[model samples]
Each structure stands twice: as structure tokens, then as C-alpha cells.
Target: MSKIFLALFVIILVVFFILNINFPLKKHEIYGKYVNRNFDKPICCVEAPHTEDTLILYEDKTFESKFYGAGTYILYNGINPEIELFYKDFNHSSSAIYKTYFLNGIFEKPKIMLNADMNHYYEKLD
Candidate 1:
């Protein structure tokens, strides 16, 4: 009887191990948490017309930009190649306001076409 009990226990343990391996634990994939805002570098728009426009990015996935006013930003990057930015008044409402932009360019400096205006280009400050 004892030998039979030991065999059953071993079989149960094997079954549990197999089941656990087949159904892996679900976990959040923290890999590549920040796609764009992972660095401490600041990207700015140095155009004299909008010299005050600056974007300071942090590793914490948060940003502070001064375009017309000071604001906070949340960056979103999933499986898609494009990164989405959500902005809010850091001193005002907590909700972010939507804007239009098709961001592109080199890593050091990024270019954005605002409201589909391809004529004017914004560059990052060194």
C-alpha cells in the first residue's frame, strides 16, 4: 500500500510540473519599456520663430515640453513603429490634449510636421 501511495505521489508531481510548464505564468513584458523617452537627452525645436519650444525626456516615461506653455507628456510605444505622445497642462488639467504630428528624422534631432504643414520644419537643439 505504501509503495502504491509513493508511485501515485510521484506521478502527481510529474503531472503538475508538466502542466505548469505548458501553461506558463502570465506576466507583464517589461522589455523595451521606453522606446523614445528612455534617454536623458532633450530634443528641442530651435527655430527662431519658436525658440521656446523644447522637449525634455526622462527615463521614467515622462516628459516636459514648453511650446506655447509648460506641459507634461506621456509617451506610448507598443508593437507599432510609431510613438504616440499625449500632452497635458502640468500646471493645469490632468487630462492631456490631442495634437497632430507626423514625427520623423535622425536620432539627435527629430522633425515634426505640424497639422500636415510640410513647408516648415522643426529641428532639435544641440
Candidate 2:
């Protein structure tokens, strides 16, 4: 009886480990928990990074973004931007810069920013 019980326990443990490895958990796949704001009209939509929450709210006459589970706002005062993006591996002191390319008309360079930059270049989906 003891031998049978030990064998059963080992089998259960092996099965559990196999299942866990076969299907690893993904980061923030649940969209309902990630809904930032409901708007009648939105300028742009943010495709959030893994394991993080993306929030873009209108404040101080500018669109500010708070990312990485942190509720700090990043100013967005430019015209229609090419895109919005964020970095999850920001090791800087509570701040970092991101640069992205935009479809600037017939011929133009990619829009760039130094620190705390968020793009507003795309139309919010209907």
C-alpha cells in the first residue's frame, strides 16, 4: 500500500510539471483587465507591452501616458503622431526615451523624442 501511494504521488507530480512546461503562462493576455478608458472619441490606441498596463489620459491640456504598472504620466503635445509605444526594460531613474518611425507624408524622417515620449499618430479603431 505504501509503495502504491508513493508511486501515485510521483506520477501526479510528473504530470503537473509536464503540463506546466507544455503551456507556460503568458503576460497580461486578459484584455478586460487592461481597459484604460472608455471614450466617445479617441485619438490613438495603445498596444500595450507584455506584463504591463498602459494608460493614456488627457491631463494638463496634453495626453499623458502612465506605463509599467506605474501611474506616472508622460506628456504628449505633438500633432498626429506616427505611433505609440513603450519599453518594459526601462532601468533608468523613473524615466526613459523612445523613438519610433512615422509615415510622414511623401518623404519625411521618423519622429523622435528624448524622454517620456508617447506617439499619437494613428486613428483609434472603431
Candidate 3:
């Protein structure tokens, strides 16, 4: 009876390991609505135009942006985490890559900066 119990335990452990390998868990903090408020200012320069764009990140690893349209996102975890956006209708081509960072060391106030331009960024809306 003891041997049978040990064998069952081993089988359960193997199944759990396989499941984790096949589907890894993802971070949930990055999912939210981010907006660029600089465009709302009346006194806007050539670099920052007068426009309002909002980015919504879903828990399913998908995102929708006013300017970028709808697409799926992949988060690369490391020292500096990065998000890669791929447009759904663009044959899975990469549209943009954003580097995530916290503002004033506040985790709740996270911001995603565009890799192409440091000044261009989206702050999480509380």
C-alpha cells in the first residue's frame, strides 16, 4: 500500500511540472488603462501635438490603443521589463516596444516609455 501511494504522488508531481512548463504564469500588475495627458495641454509644441490617446491593457495579454489600434502584447521579464506589441491585422508584425518603469518609485504609478522616443510615454490612470 505504501508503494502504491508513493507511485501516485510521483505521477501527480510529474503532471504539475508539465502543466507549469506548458503554461507559465504572467504578471497581472501591467494590465490597466494608460493615457498620454501631455496632448491635453493647450500650449503644445511640434513634438507634442493636441491629441488624446488611451491604451488599455487586458489580462489576456492583449491591448487596445487609440493610435496603435488593437493587438496582442508579450512581456519580457528581466532587470528592465519590456512589452512588445504585435498588431492583429499586420501579419503579427511588431508595432512598438515599450519599456516599463515606475514613477517616483511608486509601483501603482507605472509608466511605459516608447523605445523610439524617451519623451513619449503613457502613464497609468488610477
Candidate 4:
């Protein structure tokens, strides 16, 4: 009985590890950096550290602008793909805002059209 239990535990651990490393969920399709330019450029603010604006969507539904900072993002995939990022204040104030963008094209070659900025769109880069 002890050997059987140990073997089962080992199998479970192996399966978990494999799933984590190999088979990520469909929701993880947005896990990547979407950038407008090749180089970093400041977008959110003038004093922003980065030069290029880049949006990063993680597997855990977290996001970061890199130029501004990290935040939490939500993707509502449907007939019209939508993503919203709740960005934390740069000044460390207890303030956050949600910015929505429409996701376009395939997951691999995605382009995000920002509701705030109608002029430009962010393209996914690997």
C-alpha cells in the first residue's frame, strides 16, 4: 500500500510538471510582449524610463507597460477580442485605472487597438 501511494504521488508530480512546462492553457495565448516599435520609447509619461512603448501580457493575467510599470490585465476573448489593463499609479499613489483595447489578428500576430489612442496600434513581437 505504501509503495502504491508513493508511486501515485510520483506520477502526479510528473504530470503536473509536464503540464506546467509543456501544455499551457488556451488563455495563455496572450502571453507575450506587444510593441509598436523595435526600440524602447517612452509613451505614458515624459519621465518614463523606457523609450519605446511595449505591452507585456503574462500567463497569469498580469501585465506591464515596461515604459510605465506593471499592472493586472484581463482578456475577454470572443467575437470581438477585448483586453483591459488596470495600471497602478507611477507615483505609488493608491490609484489605478483600467484601459481597454481591442485585440486584432491572430494570437501569434496580434495587434492591439487602444481605445485611448486611436492613432497607433501595438503589434505582438514573438
Q: How well is each residue in 2-41 modelled by candidate 1, as lDDT tens digits?
A: 9999999999998776654322111122112222221222
Listed in order, each prediction's TM-score against the native is 0.36, 0.23, 0.54, 0.56
Q: Rate residue 125 of model 1 by lDDT.
A: 41
Off by over 4 Å in 1: 1-51, 68-81, 89-91, 99-102, 105-108, 118-122
1-126: candidate 3 lDDT, tens digit per residue: 999999999999987766543232236656799887555444423322246788898989888985667878878755455677766333345444433442322223566654223355677785
| Per-residue lDDT of candidate 2, residues 1-126 (tens digit) | 999999999999987766544221111111112222222233333333322233332332223344443332233333433223333435545443344432223222222221213333321211
CA lDDT of 126 in candidate 2? Answer: 13
lDDT of 3 at 53: 83
* Residues 1-126 of candidate 4: C-alpha lDDT, one tens digit per residue: 999999999999987765544222245555798785423333553332334687788888777786547878777776566777676666778656555455543233556654223334567787
Model 4: per-residue Cα lDDT at residue 53: 81
Error of 1 at 123 (Å): 2.4
Candidate 2: clashing pairs of residues:
81-120, 81-121
Q: List the residue pairs that clash in candidate 1.
A: none
Model 4 — which ten-residue stretch has the worst lDDT? Answer: 41-50
Model 4 off-target regions past 4 Å?
1-26, 37-51, 106-108, 115-118
Model 2 residue 34 CA deviation in Å: 8.2
Higher-TM-score candidate of 2 and 4: 4
Error of 4 at 74 (Å): 1.4
